[model samples]
Target: MRFRKFTSSFDTEDRLSITIDDIARPLSSIQSSFEGGKVPSEFVAPLTKFAERYGGGSFSSLFAEGKSARQKQKLVEEFGSVLYSMETEEVKNEETFLIWRDACRDIIDWGLKVDFMLDHLKQAARDFFGYMLRPSGSESSCREIIQMEEAISQLRKKLLHLEQKLGEAREDLHLRLGDDISSDSMSCILGSSWVPQSRASRGLY
Candidate 1:
């Protein structure tokens, strides 16, 4: 099938309809790393290793550089090809798939990175509270701990609200993808690879 653009329109309660482009941009520039010999062409491995040994020990740091960004894009491209080759059985139930689903929140959080973002504030508050409350007899600091606990509670409420909003957005996107097709479309998409439960009784498996 020929590729084509897909777009959607939705009236969010916030009165904004956001359109995300399908085409991905290069992660960063890749020239300085090549010039400085700081990156290797081992483009198919997980980038965490490359960053640890060469690109300053942090994926975020590598992402901050233009040259490292290009390399990252290349790495992602290669990784995506590997993903396409995987059997559905291997990916559909994997921990990696679940992490990407969970990490969608972090991805969206980074996109907004706004001042007064409650989810971000909540993460900071929880981190601070954990670090501060670890001392012996820290329970004596009840007044301060109470305030932090209140802030964290409020943050949890806000995060739940935002999660509901994101869920609605995803539902809208799913609806817009197209009316749900019949099992024929599903069979065509899955090819003759696996027998459906309904057909397996007929020795199709």
Candidate 2:
């Protein structure tokens, strides 16, 4: 996934792209800059929270740990919650919000990929069981198959919930940001060219 970093500018219309290294500078460096009053005082807390949660990791590093579907989903949900909790007033400080919004978008895009992976795994497991037929008629095999099915069911439910939460979080962001938030911006954040699906399409509302 490509990660775009925004430079320090208040004009949202003009984005100055920078390197990920520059964007994901150490938490200590950010705090030091904040203490020197280089950045707005209002940004200190949210930046600190983000650094603590992510260990000042780059977006690529964070999303690269997609080996575990559950971990990926949790990471995406946490990122969304962080974005949702950000102060709307900070939108005026275009650089901060844009950087964070881009991070959120990266997480959402990564989560979508993870969702596909999990769905594939689930289907593969089902196919394996279907091909097993009688499975030697062993009680233990039967129990294990039943357990696997139950686990898949639970995973499916969890993925559905994750989608719902992400949708709601996106809606909250739109409401807070107002007209400034556009389909292009959403697409950028979501890492998808298409606009967000309607409530009916998502089985929401």
TM-score per prediction, in order, is: 0.21, 0.25
lDDT of 2 at 3: 16
Candidate 1: the clashing residue pairs are 28-69, 28-70, 29-66, 29-67, 30-67
lDDT of each: 0.40, 0.48
Maximum-TM-score candidate = 2
Error of 1 at 2 (Å): 76
- Candidate 1, residues 32-128, lDDT tens digits: the string is 2432334333332434444455447544443323435455554344332222222112332222222322233333333321122234334433444
Model 2: per-residue lDDT, tens digit, 117-161?
223323433444444444575868878889999999999999999
Error (Å) of candidate 1 at residue 78 is 84
